[model samples]
Target: MKWYSLMPGILLLGLAGCQNFPALYSSAKPQITTEKIEQLSEYGAKFATEYNRAAQKTCTKYTRLYQQGDWRAGWVLALQVSATNNKHCLDNTAAIQILETLESQKKIDPELLWLTQVHLNWLKELEQQTKSVSQLKRAANRKQSRVNELVKENQDLVEKLEALKAIETSINQ
Candidate 1:
């Protein structure tokens, strides 16, 4: 057959192999069952309730600290509460962000400000320590690998020595 005559057939076959055009062009909306929607709503309600409870408890503790005139303790408790809430409840990071902003604005007392700086420095030290620990762990791993290699080499040398002894004994006999 002539090339031009086969071109139309090749083009049609290529298009057919590309994708399912009917499914792609279908107008039907995706079906979501009512059971799944109900389950999602229930989960959302439970999560909201739990988050509210955690938030209320954190607020109550912070308020008590504030009323007791331990502003530094209250500030630290606020941080702890935020961290705890972030870990267990909704993942809101507003507490730290607000604290940092307030610190930058110089609104906190001098003692609390000093404590914040110390806390930041301590966090930096912790990061450095973690890095050092990781480096030590890697060094230990390398040493262990070297030890394993030395053990394997020693085992090979011992086997060779035994074989040499066996050959020497046979010759002597």
Candidate 2:
């Protein structure tokens, strides 16, 4: 009989401890300095100290979301951070494996499923474009190097021929 009374009080305490849930998704909290992206636009997405701080802050948010069992949100932040910042703070690969696992679970909300697919497709396309551009640059460099070597070889040959003709003229004299 005493245990029943104690249980209600204990349960209330437990529920009260979860009060931070509202804060987790709070709309009132102003965005931190590390969360802003406008500075990145000014820098043309180049490396800067601000990016490192933002990446670290984003990584922390991802971690907090994962700890709260909000895996989808965590993966979103991870992907955004990876795409926008240098890899010194967070890996550029992002939550690829997590999203793949999420894809297999048909229980996910339709909107999230669509969003994940979009990110995956975009990432894959970007990677392919980067690879193609790199290969073209490499080919261009190789062509220029070969052209320079041929020019140098031809110059050497011309000089040798001139010297041989002078020696022949001297012998005739």
Candidate 3:
């Protein structure tokens, strides 16, 4: 038989074996109905919107501090904001635990999965923002240190110049 013909035969055999698979369908009762699905979907949409808005507010506040040259405060605030945003994200392991709890209680709301996904994305963005804030602070610190060194060097030079002039006057006298 040709390779292509034999390939189709093997594929059919594999599919036939999977026909009686019970794992694809659960025998569990309290199956999720269309009504529950709709309710969960609505809940998830609402939660995502509200959670994102809160996260955006925190980000904006932190950004303002960053712009104002408050590196220390900005760095701390950025971390806090990231933590707060992380709490709201869907990808959190704790949130998965909560889902397990809900499932065990038979109180699983499909909206939760959606919430976890939304929160996960927000946390990622917050993390990136935090890194940017940290880098900016480091750069600012470097610039400040350089300025201080220059000021000190200028002061030392001025003192040496005054002493040299005084020595010349004594030699002449």
Candidate 4:
């Protein structure tokens, strides 16, 4: 009887010691670059920084306006930044709609004209087709976001199915 009692105690002690092993966890975090649109945006930013100082300035302006909650100005600057070869505005979705609105109305800002012409002469050298680079990047980002959302929805469905299976197992038992 004593030996039997000791056996239980020994087993419990062994298990208690084994449980002290360090808990294992995932070592990697999800990254934005894994998403196609984010990768494209990064590529665009890198490419643009090589040639355009205006785009860099525009990114700074966009960040400032975004932080200040000046959504309109932020969008404008975001669009300008996206126009560069690097698509620096990929992170900001709100700016795309704002830029689209400004474009459809045929309302060009005299200030932008003056800034591009006199102050930032590099913009003047761009062809007419190149001017729409920001718009294209915005469109691409939107598409990528939609794809990401769909993937999330699918993952949620899988999780729900797993939960349902667990509930069924417990109920059946």
Candidate with best TM-score: 2
Candidate 3 per-residue C-alpha lDDT over 64-97 given as tens digits, one digit per residue, 9 for 90 to 100: 6545754322323322333433453323343334
Location of the lowest summed lDDT over 10 successive residues in candidate 1: 88-97
For model 1, residues 29-86, the per-residue Cα lDDT tens digits are 5565677557545644553464467856655555465557644433444344324334
- How does residue 37 of candidate 4 score in lDDT? 45
List, residue by residue over 1-173, the lDDT tens digit for candidate 2. 99998999999999999776544465664434542335423332333334455756655655676667765554554455445434533332555555665667553355346667877677666667878999999999999999999999999999999999999999999
Per-model tally of clashing residue pairs: 0, 0, 4, 2
lDDT of 4 by residue, 12-89 (tens): 998998776665985665443446446545644653554266655656665676567554454345345445344555
Clashes of 4: 2
Per-model lDDT: 0.59, 0.61, 0.55, 0.56
Model 3 poorest ten-residue lDDT run: 72-81
What's the lDDT of the predicted structure labeled candidate 4? 0.56
TM-score, every prediction:
0.44, 0.50, 0.38, 0.28
Top model number, lDDT: 2
For each of the candidates, the C-alpha root-mean-square deviation to the true structure, in angstroms, is 20.1, 20.2, 13.2, 27.6
Where is model 3 more than 4 Å wrong at Cα? 1-109
| Sliding window of 10 residues with minimal summed lDDT for model 2 | 40-49
